[model samples]
Target chain A: MTEWEMVVGLEVHCELATATKLFCACPNAFGDEPNTNVCPVCLGLPGSLPVLNRHAVELAMRVGLALHCSVEPSIFHRKNYFYPDMPKDYQISQYDEPLNVGGRLDLPDGTRVGVTRAHLEEDTGKTTHVGGGGGRIHGADHSLVDYNRAGVPLVEIVSEPDIRSAEQAKAYVNELRAILVAIGASDARMEEGSLRIDANVSMRRAGAEVYGTRAEIKNLNSVRSLGRALEYEVRRQVGRLEAGEAVVQETRHWNEDEGRTSSMRSKEEAYDYRYFPEPDLVALAPSAEWLAGVRAVLPVLPSERRVDLARVAGVAETDAAVAAVVQQGLDGLVTAAVGAGADGRLALNRAANELAHATPPDAGAFAKVLRMEADGRLTATQAKGVLAELVSAGGDPEAIAAAKGFEALEGDVVAGAVDAAIAAHPGEWERYAGGEAKLAGFFVGKVMAATAGKADGKAVTALLRERLAGR
Target chain B: MALISRDDVAHVARLARLDLTEAELDQFAGQLAAVLEHAADVAALDTAGVPPTAHPFELVNVLRDDVAGPCLDRDEVLAMAPAAEDGRFRVPRILGEAP
Candidate 1:
């Protein structure tokens, strides 16, 4: 048996958050009354000419620049195909010359994925198959077309075959989504179809230089679906190769419900999309000044944000907690808390864990809470409770703590609780005094329960050790 | 020799979703071949430095602002379609997914 290595590439299509369609004045919105957003140019009426939208070009360039792609002079080509979804019977897309070329995206795990090209194109209308088996095209009574999504500007980003595993593919998409949202290019909500992904997967023998036949998987609605589709496709392909059968190159549809990949269309049935330069639109050569303006406005991307946060938090940038904070856009709050003299590690952990569900509180208020925990003014459990209140309702952290009755336990009060715990758990305390350090946790739990979680665990441990030494 | 064959014409017509008669296929093949022959004559010229032209006019960056304008009425647009239902254009059963 030979070990097989999977090679994967991805095509991510993101809709630009523009006010109008790419080539017309139709509104570029989602979830409206089906055909209300359609105009003559979007509906492909006769005598309708497409004029390029300036903001769409700017947003596309913003994505390209963020990916480090070099802007180039590009022209639109009419990709002719007969589809009911496209009212024009063709899609105006960049062919030989694309706007952005030769870029790279650095995944959070330090894997650099090469970006081939991110070209701008118009999106097609959505079609809903009626009275079909599972609303599929086959066995359908008819299909309904909603032109709301048509003519929306989309940037189709194609990645090189640098991905090696399903986990890496998900990471790549996650990082890409973060960058998209960070740069304000797209909302990148995969569930709402603002962002779409198609994975091209192939398998080769381990250490083999040549590649194998690849299958392109479509309809991956989310990052999880992308991972599952690739995993299933890799197994299917490797199974065929092991059986001395050949892998057929084709486009496969990912059935999320069935957890399998089925052939949508083989290469033999693939359409011949005859492409030619679109005569209606002119070449798009962004001016040097315009590119400079876009580049200047590019925000610090998620990868760099992770590095900055990790540095501020005194942790490795590759730390999972750091990645989580940056991905959730809570790094700013964490950084501010650290700047306000809160312990870096504690601030990051709370933001990554405790604040994961709640709305982030004010930086100063959050830092005050962390300071209380660090300075022994509040126990860890009490601090978490205060943070919950602070997140749910905006208020001063100190006032919230006071109102919640989470005051710092006096030294004598904690001592009394520890004494009571030792008396109640005599056997456990005897074992702890007899050098069973593991019994420390047992005593601490008793003290915490007795003190209503107001006594600090460290204080309880210290008192227990002191009594042990006296004995 | 003809530049294009009858089979090539038939394949192109099929791709375009056009139903062409056998006689029309032969006729269009000859006509397309003649057009291709003329292109070959132009391709034979030795103008190496001339850049390829995508459009006739020497214009670039004909753009519009991002402000949205009015859209067509749904009732009027759907009225023009051959079939419509549920505020959408109703078409026959689609063959396959979008390319």
Candidate 2:
């Protein structure tokens, strides 16, 4: 394959985590019954005007500030188009003027990607096509528009064409998602439609000064798909260029199952949204005090949290374990465990290995579990058992371990079990002591069986070593 | 200048989902050109120091607190739709796919 460098830019839209919709007082929630959250303003009824949701603006501002963007005065514009998903004939979004402009995202490898702008917009309703080819829009019998999500607030972050590879694009999104969730601006769930990505990919010869014509891949829902789609698009463009075919600039759809992209619409069919200033809404001029307030309450960001984890958890800065804990949102559990006098490494290990799940135990209870494991009251396997029990039935970790007969055995009891195993199997013990190190595991198993598996394997091993030395 | 052509009108009509005849497309082309001509006159003005105006009024930060308020009844809201099913607005089979 000829050497080529890919140029990629991302447009990420994240729904703001707010209590109500962007323009109306309807509840801004997910998975509710269809159209139950709609109001006149959200439904775009005649004679109805929008009142901007203050929390949405604040959340958008929070996201911008967290990304190191300068907040400025912004205005809303009516992007006129006709779509059934949009209850109104147009969508209210930001145009030339946006709330924040000019930011940068620093990936893990220290490459900084510049953010062109991050602006606020309202999400359109969802359309579920029925009675088609596997429920697709083509050849569908009809479509249903649920207005519950029509007026939800969204912040569309546009990046500069500085990404060189698909991995970089994925890292940029992961870091951005962390910041959004850390600051409570958005849930940033990719599986749900709360966070959506559009990738514009182009390729050129190595060391080229100018970029090639780009194709925009729309609706890359997952992070994996985002990277895969970019990779496939780059290869497609490169193939076209190598085969003496010109790459056409258009919108493409990523068929995830087929692992390829097909053209959705050509450039000529692009909708020229006649955008004009929204007359009903006013300018969003965030004052100095308001900006300061939002900034002051901003939580510790993901990068800072990773540093803290490295320092507290005693993990290497480049350790994948530290990144996994932080990325999985298990940093709080680690923090609580360390604060409760648990060993940092042990706490991080337990949390990363055991507590990494969709619903982890509360931080306080998880801290107790880690502290117990640290104090040697519970062995590693016992700690895992306690964690599982705690998840299914919330209770004290120590008590759960005790109920499961996982308590640490006394030294004398373990010694007694070792003695019984030795007395019962003297020939095996003699052979084990006769230069067969692997037989130590056999003896340990015998002792565990003698004690009904209550003896710590380590303690049993220690007792067996001493008895064999005396022999 | 013939800024708005008949083809442009037809494209715009297609985007707007308007089913217009050939005569209507031609007529709308001339009318839209007149509108654009008036907009061009306004754009030709020398207003270097003037900032862009998003709204005619000088109001800023007209926002409402994020509070839950009463919503219209589902039945009442669905009653106004031309076609509704399962408490949602039903429409013709959509041809375009979501992006």
Question: Which one wins on DockQ?
Answer: 1
TM-score against native, each model: 0.93, 0.77
Candidate 2 collision pairs: none
What does candidate 1's lDDT look like per residue over A1-471, in tens digits? Answer: 569999999999999999999999989999999999998899999999999999999999999999999999899999998889899999989988999999999977778999999999999999999998999988999999999999999999999999999999999999999899989999999989999999999999989999999989999999999999998998899999999999989999999999999998875442488888999999998999989999998999988898999999999888889988988889999999999999999999999999986788999999999999999998888899889988888898889888988888899998998888888888887787778989899888888888888788999999988888887
> For model 2, what is the C-alpha lDDT against the true structure?
0.87
How does model 1 fare in lDDT? 0.92
Candidate 2 lDDT, tens digit per residue, A198-243? 9989999878899999999986999999999998898899999999
Q: In model 2, where do residues sit more than 4 Å from their true spots?
A: A267-271, A313-316, A330-351, A358-471, B1-14, B17-45
- For candidate 2 chain A, which ten residues in a row score worst on lDDT? A265-274
TM-score of chain B of each: 0.92, 0.83
